[model samples]
Target: MKAVSELLKKHDGTLWHVTPAMTVFEAVEQLARLEVGALLVMDGDRLAGVFSERDYTRKITLLGRNSRETLVSEIMTANVITVNATTRTRECMSLMSARKIRHLPVVEGERVLGMISIRDIMDDIISDHEHTIASLESYIQS
Candidate 1:
């Protein structure tokens, strides 16, 4: 399995983020603009939390809180689960499945690397499977 670092290298290294003090409305706008399901909540260079569509729905919509008035920090998931660059994609898949989460922030010590989603993991898995199958077919032909 490929390491998380390899996967990050495949895509443009753009760490999309929102400040904790930003209003939920502003964060939501960023989400919409980026067409992403989540955004890392960063306090300067430090990761503070994660804000996602689920967080907005459950915390603001279901709770009847006003997004325009509420801060991202108030609704973001503070207990974020992270993975290091060396972590394998399969390990990340397992973590995401066990936690029932779609996004994970990749960090090393205090520095944030990037974020990965279920989509990224699934794509990697599918690619791996395809490669294996192709290898098997080639071996059989040989």
Candidate 2:
């Protein structure tokens, strides 16, 4: 099975991030503009935390925090669970499921490579199953 590294080979290893002090509202706007579900919080290119729409809804909105006043750092997931490029898709699924996180930063050494989403794994799983089923049906017909 191909790994996350293979999945990211075409992504140019570009990771979108925002400043820690950015307001939650600003982050949400960027998220909408970028059409991404999450953004990494960076401190001089160092991974600080992650901001997700879920964070805004759950930690800010539900908690009665002001989005324009609340900094993303205040609601970001500080304890980020990262995955290595070499990690398998199945492993990624397992980690995401266990932690209940949808996004994972893909790292190689001290540098961030890319981000992976649960949807990525789900698509890979579905594609693989379809291929396998097709191969089985072909064999049975022959």
Candidate 3:
């Protein structure tokens, strides 16, 4: 039942982003440098879309597009899915599963807060389970 804000608290609130006009090669470099799977494509403070490894593979590599020439806007997923700080972790998991997406931007009325990945939610769930198991064991020993 932890809120998205609670989860984000554990992470460095860094919203990694790239402009839509950025070349795919540059974006890929940023992705590799940041060690992240996706980057929020931003136009100033607005959320433009998302450019991910999936986009690169499907739109660039498979199509033999030149990464150095192609722009992120051309291959980025335009219709982005976002959540707010108050959204629960379970809801996020369900939404990601239903939408078949790996990354979600946390927004507050148009202001981008941070990004959350499927891996983040899974790690939180595993941690919660471990805590619950420990609590139950402690109770049983009492």
Candidate 4:
């Protein structure tokens, strides 16, 4: 099983974040520009919460709240589920499945390291399966 650290090593370590005070409109714009579903809501260096498309849909649109008037903190997921560098890929998949969440911020103690999506874990698993299948075919031919 691959560790979160190993998976993170395969990608650029860029954590896009927005302050809690930022308007939902701004956050949504950033999400669109970045082509990401979520952004870490940051209070200074702290991980405050996660502002996602789901939050916008459920809390703002469904509730008839104006994005320009609402703050990210108002609709963000306050209780964040985080993983560590040592967490296994399978473990991450399980957590995401149970929580019905797509993104997880990787943390080391109180400091944030990076973020991973369910897509990342699934891709790794698929790649590993392909590698194993190729190895088996090679061995059979030899």
Candidate number of the best TM-score: 1
Please, what are the lDDT tens digits per residue for candidate 2 over residues 20-119?
A: 9899999999999999899988888688889999999999879999999999888999999999989999999988999899999988877888888888
Candidate 2 or 4, higher TM-score? 4
Which residue pairs clash in candidate 2? none
Give the TM-score of each candidate. Answer: 0.98, 0.93, 0.97, 0.97
lDDT for each of the candidates? 0.96, 0.89, 0.94, 0.93
Candidate with best lDDT: 1
Off by over 4 Å in 4: none
Residue-level lDDT of model 3, residues 1-142, one tens digit each, is: 6889987876678779999999999999999999999999999999999999999999999999999999999999999999999999999999999999999999999899888999989999999999999999999999
- List, residue by residue over 12-92, the lDDT tens digit for candidate 4: 788799999999999999999999999888899899999999999999999999999999988899999999999999999
Q: What is the lDDT of candidate 2?
A: 0.89
Stretch of 10 with least lDDT, candidate 4: 6-15
Residue 84 in model 3: shift from native, Å?
Answer: 0.5
Better of 1 and 4 by TM-score: 1
Residue 85, model 4: Cα distance from true site in angstroms: 0.3
Clashes of 3: 0
The regions of model 2 sitting more than 4 angstroms off are none
Candidate 3 regions with alpha-carbon error over 4 angstroms: none
